[model samples]
Target: MKKTLPAYLGISFVWFSAHFGGGFASGRQIVAFFLNHQWTSLFMPAFSMLIMGLTFYFSMVIAAKFNTYDYSTWSKKVYGNLAPVMAPVFEIMFNALLVLVTAVAFATGGSTLAKAFGTPYMLNTVVLAAVIFVLTIYGADLVRKSATVVSLILIACIFIIYVPNIIYFFPKIIHNFAAVKSGEIVTGTQNSFLDTIWWAAKYGALQCCAIGAYIVHAQACPDKASLKKAAIVGFFINTVVMYLSYFGILAFVDQGVLKEAVPSLFVVMNGVGGAWMTVLISLCIVIGAVSTGVALVYGTTNRLANFFGRNMSEEERAAKRKIHCISSSAMLVIACWMVAQLGLIPLIGKGYGNIGWVSLLLLTVPILLRGLGLWRFAEDVPGKVAAE
Candidate 1:
């Protein structure tokens, strides 16, 4: 069956695409993280690419080798009760992160449609949220297909708009390169490595590791070799896409102005790419946003059903299920939308990274403890894994 073509890679790409969106969707994140340094943003993604690549290998490798999809089982065996104890915290973090992502999708989608046409933000928001809910209730195949299409669209738009621009800015790129190499220019974002690590932790990278592992377990890969291959492939694909996205933003926007917007990639892109292309990518961004909402909510709902021992509803029982589902969906959307509307950019800015930390602390600690010869102290607890 071609083993489903590694759904995790496609998921990772869509997931990482969320991280690379927002302010970093333009050049701001790159400017903050690597442009301040030498040729590092160029190299930073690669460095992460390498570390994540190795870590991913181990994740799928271990899970697949065990033939056990219950990540909790692995976690407990690796970290004793500590892994089990941390489950609630990880879920809370994930829920909060999902709430926030949903908000971003709604707000961004509304803003884009409002900007492009005379659409009411609320109406646009309602339309988008409804779409997100439908997509979520349906599941991942729709999301993967949607994301694959949207990612391709944005990727094409980025190339068409930014490649020549980068070539044009080659001189500035060189000057920035020499300055960073010579340590002559510091855009003065200190603790940048720690910042990115902290950033990676707070946001999706670390969380995505867990998510990736979950997907691996869900898909029921039967061997360490298969699992590791999946993780490596997933991370490698994600990092490349993220880095390409970073440069695309840089090539198209002025870094100085990008610093001010802080969270809106569109302000930067719309300015540089011409209003029409800006409008086009904005719609694409909104589409990607919907894809994200679909992916997260779909994953979350399935996870929740598994958590609560709920079966997939069939027939008229689905009516009650529908109520339950809509309640959950509404709660998430409204809360996130409120946050988005209230200008919680500063607060939610680290949402992804914070959740990432929780995921890393729970998952990585267990693996490291086990891998580093500390396994005897742990226990194997019951865990459930489902990819249905």
Candidate 2:
């Protein structure tokens, strides 16, 4: 069966959410960096999502051209050796990021647990991690399916409220940003949008594998041409989702309250409505947290298995993959528990938020450089050979 647009769209949105959860969900990381006081943050995620759309388009172009199982070969073929290392090196950093996320999930999840059960958040985190770890070890299909399902719930929750109000929200955000620009209501950062773009460069660690879905899509695509098509469709779907999510949350929230979390968008979201809306969003978030957690563990597992596959037989390689999945999940859960024990919100914001931008920049550079590098170095080779 031909791949449907909805399938690709769902994949793209899930990946973006999986990668940029802390930022995109509540505008915690990117929103704050870009919007700051008034309206700047309000407009930029919309634009950034558009850029993401382009990145998605290009990813397909590059992937199909290379036709490789792992992007490392794509990079190596293009850049010699440098590009091969970009993605995998980053994947290894999961140990640190997992701890951070586990902490936030527990910290925030704790409050929800408390209201719901009068329980400590730390205890809830351990329970959640145990479940996530086990499910992730079982298989990739399970986690991938879970991510899509949870992401849909998230998109629905945002749209249920925002889509109808878009015509209204845009004008207010624009007015607020205008006022901030003119020093009218002390809104939007003086140069908040610019700051967000600059800051997004270094913010990838928190969201490192958020783009794993892109890689997965690229690898599994039937051909390079089909991959580009997938990327194009995927990009728009994701951007639209981000745009709706950005404005939707802002409609019910203000900057001062958002600052309380010191870079958490969910904290802002916690106040996005009355009892029903609150319950709806909160439920979506819990599911989202689970979906993302599962994605992280799975992405890390596959990348590791591929990285070490050269020495193993096909059967050995497949067996190794299972070990990677199971062991990594357990290790990550342990790390999360450790972070939860120490507390993790502020650390994630300050540290992980910065690395995200770097990843974006790093990801594309090899593609550009490797192609150019090969061109420049072509003359030095013993004989001219066609490109891979």
Candidate 3:
């Protein structure tokens, strides 16, 4: 039952698509978290790779071993008696924040389109939400396959935007690299090297909650060894994307263009092949946002359905899941439209920055403890849950 290399690649692509939302694709996350730090930005990829790789490996191992693919059951295994108390709190906070972030991504993508082609923001939002809603309703397999296809195109577009610039701007970037200094503030706060490390680690950990459902659903690898390979492969893919994005932004920092809201777009507008390339990169950004939006919405609905349908008959459960998906998607689209009115920068700073740090303690710490063998589950634990 071991998954083949292609299976792992497909799962990894889904994970990458889900995790790399509008913030990342727009270069805002890179500018705020890494590029603002000057030369220290170079260290983020390794730190992110370590934290995210371990998180994925352990989460998948737990999912496969315990047959607890939903967050509620997974929390029970991790937190024991605290599961009842933590489940609702974590669920509300995690899903709400994810929805808010995703909504902002959609809004940003819409606004980007509006700027590009004079399209109406409302129309763009409707089209984006509709696409995600339809894709999610088809469920995880479709989401995974759609994400893989989108991710491949996304990677290609990113290289087209960044690689040539990195080559052409090589000397200028090198000359400006050491001249750049630390102490540049990002998101209204200054970050030292240690702060950057903390931010990277926390961001990676926060992703645990966001990607939990996908990791659970991607249990194609039946054995620990194969699962580990999938996680490693996923990590590499993620790290490469991060590296390219970070350096792509860093390559043009001396131009002062990083000050823009969408630094990657600014870079493409200035450095890449211009109008046509801008349109292509813009399409890539919208696709990335859509991929992330679908994943979050689907994951949130799946969690809700599993929680409410826990004791239902199989037929009833199936019916309830359909209802939950439709209702939740509709509600999410409306709520996201409203919240996105608050704008993109505030959402990323206020929403992700605070919630991300909290997840480090709630999700990452416990999972790391278990992975390190410092914590143990009872031998009968899996059987007890399975029997229930």
Candidate 4:
């Protein structure tokens, strides 16, 4: 028998794609969470990713140990006897997060293309929704593969768009860095370092919710070591890309980049590249949004399918799983498109913050408390590896 090896790279890319989605790509999340806090922006993103990576590591290890790949089952194990009480609450929180992030992603793609090509926002949103719907129809394997492809393209585009701007605006970034340090350039409502730390924590909690997407793929990891490697790799990917984008956006702080609806597009329009860069970044944003939607939508669809098919036998459920997948995918996608109408900025700024706080209580805190105590026993079984 051929051994099924863990897909560390693929897992890392899935986490990365989910994190570097619409909000991060548009620079809205950075501005809202990190950059808005002024000088704290320099290191806060790294701090946030650290929190996220740790959470992901523990979550994956727990999933691998318990042979529970879905978030619902995984959460129940993590919660132990509290499963009966807390599991349903977690279910609600996870679904709410799915709705919010997926909606933001759709809004991001729609708004990005609308701004880039002067198209109708609704049409753009619907088109983006359709793309995600098709992508989510397949299953976890396809979601993983698509994430790898999208993440590579996004990484290249981010470097392409951000590197030039960072080069061209080096002096401005340096000046702003010093100004922020000296309390001369503060864009945030609160300039305290502790406040920035708090904000980073909140953002970390929100990002931690991506474990819903990742848990389904945890069975792909053959060992706890692979899970750790995936988290560390994911950490570096998120941190480096975040730092680059943060620096690039910082260059425009004095120019009021935060005031713009899409700070990244504003940066590109005002930075090293010209019209071509605009088109490229626009493409980058749309694809990033789609990648996020695909992973998240599939995660939710998986759970929904399991829920709706809970009473059926194995053979019957297998026959109806695809239909369940399609139905759930369509319901979630349509709901998200409607939510996207609330606009991108509001979704990132207002919606994300609230979700972060709630997630910290319902998701992040439970994982940390439970994972620390349970991880020592989470060794992989030799012949019991989950089938993909």
lDDT (C-alpha) at residue 127 in model 1: 86
Estimated TM-score per prediction?
0.74, 0.76, 0.90, 0.92
Off by over 4 Å in 4: 1-6, 342-348, 374-388
CA RMSD for every model? 5.1, 4.9, 3.4, 3.2
Where does candidate 2 stray beyond 4 Å? Answer: 1-7, 20-23, 37-43, 56-79, 83-103, 163-175, 192-197, 200-209, 249-255, 262-273, 306-310, 319-324, 368-388
Candidate number that wins on lDDT, 2 or 4: 4
Model 3 C-alpha lDDT per residue in residues 227-287, reported as the tens digit of each score: 6777887888888888887767777776776688888888888886888878887887788
Clashing pairs in 3: none
Model 1 scores a TM of 0.74
Global lDDT of each candidate: 0.53, 0.53, 0.73, 0.83
Summarize candidate 2's per-residue lDDT along 1-388 as a digit string, tens digits.
Answer: 1243334444555465564343345455545544454454555554555445445544444545545434445444444444446545644444455556656665555555555567777677777787678767866445545666666677787676456555555666566445556675543355555565554334422243244434545544445345445556555655677666555544434445345442223433344344565565455555556666666656555555576676888999887877766776676667766776776566766775545555556554443343334343442244322131
Worst 10 residues of 2 by lDDT: 379-388
**Number of the predicted model whose TM-score against the real structure is largest:** 4
lDDT of 3: 0.73
| lDDT, model 2, position 98 | 51
Per-residue lDDT for 1-388 in model 1, tens only? 2245565545445544444444444344455545444334455666555545555554544454345334433333444556556655555655666777667767766776787787988888788877877765544455555655666676676565555545666676566556555566544453555665554433334444434324423343444445445556656655665665555444433345335443234433444456666665565567756766666666565554333335555554445654655555665656666766765655655454555566666655556455445554523333332221
lDDT of 2 at 287: 58
